[model samples]
Target chain A: MNLDLRLDTSGDFYARKFQPTKREDTLILNMGPQHPSTHGVLRIILEIDGEYILRAEPVLGYIHRMHEKMAEVMSYPQYLPNPARTDYLHGLAWNWAHVAAVERLMGLEVPERAEYIRVITCELNRITSHLLWWGAYLLDLGAFTPIMYAFDDRERIQDILQRITGSRLTYCYYRFGGVSNDIDDRFIEETRKQCSRMKPRFKMFKDLVTDNFILRKRVEEIGEIPADTCRKYGATGPVLRGSGVPYDVRRAEPYSVYDRFDFNIPSYDTCDAMGRYLVRMDEMQESIKIIEQALDTLPEGDYIMPKAPKKPKPPAGDVYFALEGARGKIGFHLVSDGDKSPYRLKLRAPGFSNLSLFSEVSEGVLIADAVSILGSLDLVIP
Target chain B: MSEENAKPEKAPDKEKEVKKKEEPQVPKYTGYDYDCFLAPQELLKAVTKLDHADFFLEDVSCVDMQEGFQVVYHFDRFSQPGRVVLRVMISRENPEIPSIYDIFPGAAWHERECFDFFGVRFTGHPNLIPLLLDPEHQGPPPLLKEETALKDLNQLYPDRVHTPVSPDSEEFVKEINNCSNQKSRNQS
Candidate 1:
């Protein structure tokens, strides 16, 4: 029962792959497909010389459910609930992107009311996403109380969303032509109360967290990524906005009723962890503004289109539809051959692009600051 | 198209010399920057051109069509936002295309993901390994179709115009040189 054989065999696959690269002074660290700060099933392989990181490579595919394959196999309507699973926090935006892609291909006309409903509900979901990122990111940097404050507001918003969406996290409220249910007066009233309620909370957040000296020191100038680096890696959403190029798909490639709404795309040229942090905080307020404007001009019409195809067979062609999700630009590339099932369905997750830039930015940084930078990316590792 | 749309190619970031609007039959995909089919040899050239024009690679997607693998590279610009979809067809026998990772470092993972699902080899890719697929898992690529399930390119892209492109010209030669000289092709 000597321990030599067992210890040698017990090293996992990543550990085995990393062994050949080991040098005299440098250390290789495998940081979680399970570590709490990772936010999801993502593992980063780090080559470090003492505390400073020499090189870092994020190895993905841990929770690879093969969602793209599922899209090809499932019928048009049967694939509705699956997209939400990719980015659970901003579920509605993914839902809308998928539905909108199919709608564009099939030429289904969505009612004006349905478009407004999508706008209102999607903004509420965006707030929940940013709030979670805010708390979890702060928690990663060694703060705990902020998460409680975040979840407190997050739960109230989820309650309002769950009333119509019928689920708390992974939502499937959107259909091909329109939404599953229409927004009632109670829903609008509750949302208005919640929106007004969140304004003061954001102010409280600024005083309690943003303005704190220690937190500012942790995030302020750490991991500065210039605008040039952002373009090369194709990083989008707040990560791109934080670098000072105002490219929001809602504004850039205006899809749905987003064109009609008036809301600023918040960006900061500081290009550090604090820049990304500030961007999300301001974006949540902007989401509230969009939701309010949408509610004010909510039209009276059918919730779902009358002639929306139950089993859609789009004419032979393909389309690429993108929308502004909370994380970034969520794109759907669908190819059809006039079939009930899609020939090819490629999902362009924003997290994928945002995460790609990590290896380049993480070099020459302290291990702890690397964690702050990763957290600021707000990755939900789809 | 209006005067505004007509001058997209004449914009400072773009070159008016090689606007290859040769395939008049190709229908623009409404909102996109228009589609172009290129030879595998020309794939790297086109990518380099786009990279020099400040267009960033969005994603590298592969579709298993009848003719071969349709390797679609999507790119967009910050200064002028529009999707430039470059579709290159590879033979079914050997699904290989030159990697754009040297031009766009972000394409590394995407190329691996494409390879893992479609068995499409990205030549010159630094570490071409399975991305989403587990290494221990034993089976053919999940997305590859059997012979019976395969559909022809014409059926998949009914609106596609496939006029044969002319041979390599001096204009393209200078375009490739400009991209290579200006941006240092990424090593990893």
Candidate 2:
């Protein structure tokens, strides 16, 4: 066997193609398809003049699995587990979006109890997602101890979710008309216990990290994205809320039992990295509130619809369903041709939109602040 | 630069704008509040109307239908939440459409994804290279349906009307403007 292992000194295809301006002083740098702070396989090509970045372009598709193509070939039920893989941190939201889109198209009615369960589990999942982000983001900024505290809470939620969903991450718990498994009395008791425990932990987190002078200086006013820029780029979730839009998909477009819950959409007008940090921190508390409310108002009924189709063949038409995932708005656009499988399914990953604005926001900021801005975005590159 | 030159140019443009009014079909079955079909040329104008109306672009997606390539653009507002889907049908032989990148800026990646999947050319896109596929891969676009598997617009849409609305029409402008004010499906 002949092995041609000659090193290409010029650069890879993406690097060579990402031509810098005709300036002798500027240098092109690749941040990572492997860099630690990126948190996943995200490569950012940057043109920097000394420490300040002149231009930044994110090169994607390193981990593209073509889930859309998978949906085309698979049946409705067969495609259930695919959405969860897109954003593993907030898998239930993606699962909900996929199932809810199909259910809306078929006009299947979900029992009230099922809606409450979805709300509780999904909110719990949201907290875990935020917790992981909080820890990983702080770790990216060179802090390690916060992740320990974050995981303590995260593992508990994962254990609770693992029992019902059968997996800690990338959960496929939601079904067409309802969830796959019903919650028992022990599940409720554990969730209530966790929610109560989380309240004081948040206060500790604030005093320990959020209000710390060093952490505040590192994050505050680092990446200032105006509200108008957020709208222009279609950035959502905390990224948009951090810019002070308060445009949560839950309140803006109510889905499931979100409207029934009384919770505040925490927003900051600072339009900086600290604003985003604070929003996520406050949002975890709101999730606890939502879970507590749902638990108190838990109704009794079937978890999954009795007549739910095993192999759903929705009528010929299309439906668009969106939900508030931890990252942002997770949308599923399903087109049916009166077949067991979707004719064409498109996923609107909110991280894609949120990250798109990075190129614009990262310009003129120092390289370290670029990492801060990226961390503040809390991206889960699927 | 003179008013006289602008007057003659504006006259014929006004005359050409006197096309028949077409009302967008509000199909209650679909989750969209307003669903309209537009000629490829009118996409930018319609998108500009949406931008002025304070609607944010959700995502731009494309579907390969037997009739043509249907490029779908989903938009929603923060203040008043309602989904408005714009469907532009372009010929399969030349699957080209005007890019909304200059207006939304976020459609750049979505258009590239469409190009990578279905080989749809987004004209005026600053960077139209492959976004989520291997740049060196040599094969046909992956998402194109087999000829036998193709379904026409009627088969996919069924009962919905497919009339192409003129972007310059008063009714079209009004519909785009009022789409957000209309109560969302969940609220109704």
For model 2, what is the C-alpha lDDT against the true structure?
Answer: 0.90
TM-score top scorer: 2
After superposition, candidate 1 runs with Cα above 4 Å error: A1-6, A9-23, B1-30, B164-188
Q: Model 1, A1-382: lDDT tens per residue?
A: 6565544543565555553234678877878889888988899988888899988888888888899999989998999999999999999999999999888776677899999999999999999999999999999999999999999999999999999999999999999899899889999999999999999989999999999999999999999999988888889999999999988988877777887988998899999999999999999999999999998999999999997888887766788888889888888999887679999999999999899899999989999999999999999986
Model 2 regions lying over 4 Å from their true place:
A1-7, B1-29, B181-188
Every model's TM-score on chain B: 0.71, 0.81
Evaluate all candidate structures by whole-model CA lDDT and list the values in order: 0.85, 0.90
Model 2 alpha-carbon miss at residue A289, Å: 0.5
Worst 10 residues of 2 chain B by lDDT: B18-27
